[model samples]
Target: MAKLHLIKLSVGTETIESLRQWQAGKQTQTADGLPRHVTRMWPKRADELLDGGSIFWVFQGMVQCRQRLLRFDEVIGQDGIRRCAFVLDPAIIPTTNALKRPFQGWRYLQPADAPADLPAHRQTEDELPASLSAALADIGVL
Candidate 1:
């Protein structure tokens, strides 16, 4: 059983290249004296998420890239609150553009509902401007 993992559209990440740099820089946050990307509220279906799930990042009103789930850890923050640390594989796999309404926090994504990974040959879209990409998508040219 796979589960969905979601991240808010990054405020600073406008392009995939920028996201790659951001992600490279995002990996070293300290959690419980160790490095991890932890979020509040441990997911109830951690097993399913760890089984075979990717954290889908929402970008520019659409679901974009993903990082594979590796493991989960419990961390106690400086405020003495416990959070779920999602240890993820560093690879970011791009996905087909799929529109999504804005929402708070991470949400579970069922496998059937997850966007398909973009094909390797269809990588040219990354070179286009966001608006041009959107226009091409709207015109079925992407």
Candidate 2:
């Protein structure tokens, strides 16, 4: 296990199920290296991010799912800014819901702080309403 990555989803694209669909769709496209996301800056800990790390996705302001980090590359934007292109594997692993505040950029997710992956049989709850799940997790009753 290695340190992970955390990213806030853009508005209207926050559901864990939606994330799974997105990952699936991306895989259907020709394998263009790895699935990439544009970011303002490249992570300094690229080695750590690629070392058996997963990207914890914050959906609807809560942690929902993760994807393995295949790699990260630097991409220069049209405006000449060097940006990070996070290359992620297509598999979206569900995780127990965890609350997170809105943030401007992706952050490092320590292995210890990242939520445990939901077991295959337990992934049914992934479709539950975020509010209900968050409340349950808050009380340690989820």
Candidate 3:
């Protein structure tokens, strides 16, 4: 089966660097030292998600980067409610910028609909502002 992926808005994040800094904090990591994002719902297709899927992060209104989905862990909140934790690989791979509208929670992304990883030469290029990138994408210049 083709691997599945998730796309989530990185709220309050303006740039990829800021997202990196936020995830770098110790509080954002699990006890095992891997970065994880806690969410309210566990994916019903967990089996496919574990088959080399990744979580693509949207900064501003553009999909910017991705991290491999290592696994999902069950987490209990202080209120004793169960939640899902998305265990992520530490490497944040940059991707070709793609615009996405605002949405709640996460959405499943088919591989065909996902943006390609940035080419090595472009990966290190300075990031364009989100609006500019989105505009370029709209014009098919990105």
Candidate 4:
């Protein structure tokens, strides 16, 4: 059986609303988009990652991203130890150039760990393309 998991992706504060609107507009543009009863919800896992100082990286292809656990600091009170947190990194965070539709940005997701439906690429996690690494490093996250 496939392991079910939740994935989280980073989004800009300013672009979130527009993204939401774009998602809604998808139904009108395509016959099959998001379900009518399925409304996108906030309090997303991504928000928690941001609040905890964790960074999300966008990769290419489904199953490309991996899940890892880390600990982050959260202020409980005057004195206390930091807490641990879990977050999902989208396999690929589509960049402007890589996207078919134009928008701020979008995260590629595979509902759960059902093996990525996208094409497969044989590349080790540490063997990222130089361009991608540079882009990530430029953002001070790599």
Best by TM-score: 3
How well does candidate 4 score on lDDT at residue 84? 28
Looking at candidate 4, what is the lDDT of residue 60? 33
Residues 49-124 of candidate 1: C-alpha lDDT, one tens digit per residue: 8888878877777776777888888888799999888776767788776666778778888888887888988755
Error of 4 at 16 (Å): 23
Per-model TM-score, in order, reads: 0.78, 0.84, 0.96, 0.24
lDDT of 4: 0.31
- For each of the candidates, give the backbone clash count: 1, 0, 0, 1
Question: Which stretches of model 1 miss by more than 4 angstroms?
Answer: 1-8, 26-36, 135-142
Q: Tens-digit lDDT track for model 3 on 25-127?
A: 9978999999989999999999898898999999878898999999999999999999999999999899988889999999999988888999888888999
Candidate RMSDs in order:
3.3, 2.7, 1.2, 16.8
Predictions in order: lDDT: 0.70, 0.73, 0.90, 0.31
lDDT, ranked from best to worst: 3, 2, 1, 4
Question: Which structure is stronger by TM-score: 1 or 3?
Answer: 3
Kindly state the number of residue pairs that clash in model 3.
0
* Candidate 4 Cα misplacement greater than 4 A, ranges: 10-63, 68-84, 87-121, 125-142
Cα RMSD, model 3:
1.2
